[model samples]
Target: MDTYTTTIAVASIVTSGITISIGVIGPALSEGRSVATALSSLAQQPDASTTITRTLFVGLAMIESLAIYCFVVSMILIFANPFWNHAIA
Candidate 1:
């Protein structure tokens, strides 16, 4: 591989890793906190367990999408990076 390609490859790998690391940390912490809060709410209001659970699931899904988007971006950078084209060309 040419120096350009090598540089692109290294940068892409590093960027993708950083993206996942930062992306996951936020969602993971938020998910844990949200779950804890939901549990407390349910405990205090057992009659609203269904509503709380439903809301929790929806919130979790939305939070999880952030991680998913990061994963997809990382995958793109690793496998189908547009930069590679310019580097090789």
Candidate 2:
């Protein structure tokens, strides 16, 4: 409710938004590249489709985890904001 709290809230929201965007964009691009590469490899080597598919799944999982983490951080900013309490106190 005070100026400090207002500033913290605004900063937290901005930072969380930026972090979410960066986190999502990077992983999205990485996932897309991974899939494209995997598909290309699979096309070139039909016999290695199983291995490529397995690796592609692993890469996708890792990339997705980053986005999930960002989502958690954004949710924390919007709902369970620690900075608000810290600023008030």
Candidate 3:
């Protein structure tokens, strides 16, 4: 490959790796903390288990969306990168 193509490939790979790594870390930590907090609240109020679980699931889904977005971005970078076209041209 030419220098331009090589550079683009390397950059895309590195950027995607970094994006996925950092993105997953944040959400993982957030989800862990959220679950811990919810568990503590549930322990304190067993009567509210249903409400707490529903809210926790919703919140977890929202938090997980961030990781999903990062995965999509990384997939685009590695597979359907626009720079590939530019490099080819």
lDDT of each: 0.96, 0.89, 0.98
Write one digit per residue (lDDT tens) for candidate 2, span 22-58: 8899998998899999989998999998899998898
Report the lDDT tens digits of candidate 1 across residue range 1-89. Answer: 59998899999999999999999999999999999999999999999999999999999999999999999999999999999878877
Question: Candidate 1 local accuracy as lDDT?
Answer: 0.96
Clashing pairs in 3: none
In candidate 3 the C-alpha lDDT for residue 56 amounts to: 100
CA deviation > 4 Å runs, candidate 2: none
RMSD of 3: 0.9
Instruction: Please report, as a residue range, the 10-residue window in candidate 1 with the lowest summed lDDT.
Output: 80-89
lDDT of 3 by residue, 43-71 (tens): 99999999999999999999999999999
- The model with the greater TM-score, 2 or 3, is 3
> What's the TM-score of every candidate structure?
0.98, 0.88, 0.97
Model 1 lDDT, residue 37, Cα: 100
